[model samples]
Target chain A: MEYETPLFFHVMRYAVRADRDVIDMVSGNPDWEPPEALREGLREYADLESSEFQYPPSDGLLELREEIAARRGVDRDQVVVTNGAGEANYLAMARALERDRGSEVLLTDPVYPYYPGKTTLLGGSQRFVAAGEDGQLDPERVREAASTDTSCLVVNTPNNPTGAVYPEETMRELVAVAEEYDAILLSDEVYDHYDLSGTFASALGVESENRIVTDSVSKTLAITGFRVGYAVFPHDLAEEAKSRHMLINVAGSRPAQYAVLDALRETDPAYHEANRELLAERVETFTGALEAAGAEYTRPDGAFYVMARFEGYPGTLENVEALIDDIGVAGMPGEAFGDSRSDWLRFALVTPRVEEAAERLAERFG
Target chain B: MEYETPLFFHVMRYAVRADRDVIDMVSGNPDWEPPEALREGLREYADLESSEFQYPPSDGLLELREEIAARRGVDRDQVVVTNGAGEANYLAMARALERDRGSEVLLTDPVYPYYPGKTTLLGGSQRFVAAGEDGQLDPERVREAASTDTSCLVVNTPNNPTGAVYPEETMRELVAVAEEYDAILLSDEVYDHYDLSGTFASALGVESENRIVTDSVSKTLAITGFRVGYAVFPHDLAEEAKSRHMLINVAGSRPAQYAVLDALRETDPAYHEANRELLAERVETFTGALEAAGAEYTRPDGAFYVMARFEGYPGTLENVEALIDDIGVAGMPGEAFGDSRSDWLRFALVTPRVEEAAERLAERFG
Candidate 1:
């Protein structure tokens, strides 16, 4: 009855204190500076009126909500700023349950594991639809799985682990299924800006009354620690979202909100272009090493990761462990994400030493 | 069934867009600057390794937890850092419910309004124990209320709304009751630093296996918007607390954690002393005006609020509305806190113009 894997922490703890040369790629922590405008924003916020730090308006500061609304093409009241996309997802799922929307939550196999955990915490059941090779959602299969008891469907595009950037047609079909079944479609589009593939479409773009889009300044701005995110809700669910937000975390981080507000206003489109380009180069270099090692990998269309299978061995937890201990290279096991794929190992090319890590893997696997 | 009142926000919202001269005694937001050490800390954190901006460790930064643990006299593992005490309390209550510890959550009648709302959200029923005349707990009343089905009891010392700082003997007896019934005792000591009557005992100071202490820098440091707090759970419950925290909010504000760490390291005891002194002055000035106006009220021992009843008026929402519209002053009605008090109005002494607010109240009531 005790669920105690510590999830991603179990994979990263060993490498945290290891020698500096050890290549740690088990987590999604970005390796880049946030926009300079954020730091400049912090300096200005530090001198605001003393009461500026009061319990911020529970839904969020109006100014920040206004900005999020403008960016998403929603009204200010439709936005509920949250601690992170983490909390935004929690609020959405909890709302679905609270309103008797459904006790059954739907997810994709090879899922971001945290989705299942959040569903469990809120006392709801999860049923995942397996993705196609390289993590593409099969819209027809998803539509088949829809039922009256399904309360929610979660889609993470520019998806994690498999790294597929969902196409607009697929996204439209997903939204249609949610609308047809009267179930909530909760999308975590925090990585929308990092659409390495130009075909990525946001649920926010093709609006439906049942769609709830959760996003954060974290991935794009590289400020995950600041904990400022938002959920755009259907107008009907907006009040519930606000109340639930208050009961859960009260409000998002205030200083982070101000900093992000400034960053959003001042950040040049070129900043996002540069980051996308950097990820593309890393993906090419690391996947090339896998190809040379005689390993089979699915090249990702967007996110900075590739899923590969080492020749002569499946990617089990033990193999992941040995890769760390024997080669000083760490990676996430596919099984850690979902039960569907134990043969695939997930590698994040987030570190500057991706080439070295790939060379080490090629030395043994080749 | 729709719990629409956003509590603290309902009080503060009216004044938010009002004239600058409007005195808002509706919120506990302090009218003072945080320690200068926090600003200097920000400057240092601004330059940390780029990965520092990535997701923080889910439970919290080890260094910050270690500091909180040392100060609270608990081991680092017992602390689960959360997004403000809001999330800490949510995790604790949800854990209690998830384990089937009990079906009901107990609270003082004049409770912090947020408690009942949280218990409801987690699918648990709420039971109330009415406070004594001055909003103090009579150990016997609480002991008599205890039952095997009571999953948890929340005691906020320097109680919000009433400001009753529970006596050590009362706290000890309350813990004994929870021990006998084997129910969790959640002590929210966020306001302990504001103890004016000098009688504050942490539930941590009295050992009990079924207890959790939720604290935060928000109230003490005057930065509720920072959204960083922690809960110390029984060793057996620590894992559940961590999992629930991750599922709810991932981690608290990361940059705030670093800044608070530096502030914790450099803050002089003199700083807290000065803050306590200022609250003492505000309480005196405001309450003196209450007495002169012939209003019936109970003085608070800690925290920065006083409960008073204007002659011929039963502290209803309508009365509060009149106060805001007629006098440009805002306050919370006691009915919002609990159903037991329909005749008492709660006024926070947080405004810098406590004297002016008091003068306005006296002119109208006297």
Candidate 2:
């Protein structure tokens, strides 16, 4: 029942609370504020006494669904609002498993930890396909992992920990594989807006029935705590997904939904541009420090994270604690993610004072 | 998959929209604005920077937890914030089932329909014990329902559909049943503040180890759509419950949480007193109209609902729809609640125009 992210974060908080100069490079939080327009929308929505404060339609508010449809280029009926992408992913898996018992969920090795965690929690078996050394998921590996028992496959693009964005061709091939196996594809596109390569891809763009897209305003709007997210499914499965979502968590927050709807309608393009620039700059600064420290790491094309391998530092629980205690920084061990190599560690470059954090790391490891 | 309440209310809305004169006695919504102090507190909290929108501590905001603990007279570690009382009840049952596979969930007959729906969805078995003809649950009947296979028992005092509040002796007997069977007591006390009989009771006040209380500000503050609720559990199960709650929905809304905290701290006593008085008056007016119409019904002791039985008219789907279509009044048929021989219908006196509604009903039924 314990969540690894919060548990690790709590440990780090306790480790550094007394130290004023401690740097937090552990959480995958975006160190930016939502656009001014979004904030104003929240203010306006909060002022009005309307049905927004009452129980919303079980599916979702229409305007929010329309906005998602407009942005994702899908029919409004294809989408369902969820608590967050996490819950959406969980619902998709649960629905798929319920529809076909004794089914397995396929995951890419070094996947976003939640995928496997949710799979286990839902009483489904998981099969992992190793990503190449470049941290990219190859279509052939996925095809090899697919089986008649595989009912669902979770794919996170511009992925967490690795930051590998699947190319259009790769996604098309993967969709073909899912079609061949008759499996549901659960695409976690929560980090869609953070594609630094300027080449974002979505499985929903493909013409296929075996796809469910999960995304949230957390990363895009810098409002993770608001917990407003959604899933897009084929018309045939949308009802089941919606039902499971409601049964699991009655509905998302009333005010937060209004705020998210406002954020989407009013936020300017320049706000996203500014956020992208800030994140790109921080990623460069931190990766440069990692290089100066003689660390081997994958420079992410997107997201505010990079996985680095330090000499003689096998990613273990003991080493993780040492890094926090001795270096005054916190990062996730790759071992916690999957059955992959144990020499890598995940660092989040989401601190506002990126330059200072880089300097501190350089002083300790350079 | 579809929720009966929302669907029923939607049909009621369609009828209301078709004719503005139609009286809505179907929705369990409260008819009062949030306390002014709470609204102001929300405005103040909303003005804070977007950092407050970041991912919440998986458990919940510590301030809200402390407030709930102080109010419930429980230890701070015993409280967990959930999406709503619905989600709290859902998660509590899920946790119990996880602890004991294929657990049986015992519910009072004519109980809140959500309990049975959620339990069935969670893959748990449900057993029902009939409450007395007075619309009150009998302790001996509940004791008889408890068995070795019973993993959890759900009790809603100040109950829904039927406004029967469990007295102290009845609650004590139920607690003994739970303790004897080693089963968890899942108490839904969302309507705790709406007690018109001046007999406010809580399972937490009874000092039971096998009890969890689910309550929300929705009813008290008249913000049913805000979707903010909490569950207070014994210390032994607090961590598991907190983790499962967060895993399911992450956390409740930031602004809503801050608003409830402010409401709990600053809302004047007179505001609540006035609300109670208004509801009490409506109950009296509506009951008088029903009596004049020659309907047989039990007087509500608490909550904003009254269940009435009509002579020569068994409560059926046809009758409920006829009342809406011809009589221009909407109510829930008793069949949806449980299998009972009594021909009854439920009316929610939560609207401001209850007097006019009563007059409209009297015109048709009398």
- Cα lDDT, all candidates: 0.84, 0.78
Per-prediction DockQ, in order?
0.69, 0.56
lDDT of 1 by residue, A1-366 (tens): 344243578778766655555798887767867889988888777777767766777777788899889988899988998988988998888877777867998999988888888887766888889998768999898988888888999989888888899998998999999999899889898888888889889898778888899999888898878888989999998888888888888888887888889999999999899988888888888889999999999788877678889866777778787778788988888888787778888888778898998899899889
Question: What's each prediction's TM-score?
Answer: 0.97, 0.96
Enumerate residue pairs that collide in model 2.
A54-B225, A55-B225, A225-B54
How high is the lDDT of residue A177 in model 1? 91
Judged by whole-model lDDT over C-alpha atoms, candidate 2 comes out at 0.78
Docking level of model 1: medium
**Which candidate has the top score in DockQ?**
1
- Docking tier of model 2: it is medium
Candidate 2 wrongly placed segments (more than 4 Å): A1-7, A15-20, A50-52, B1-21
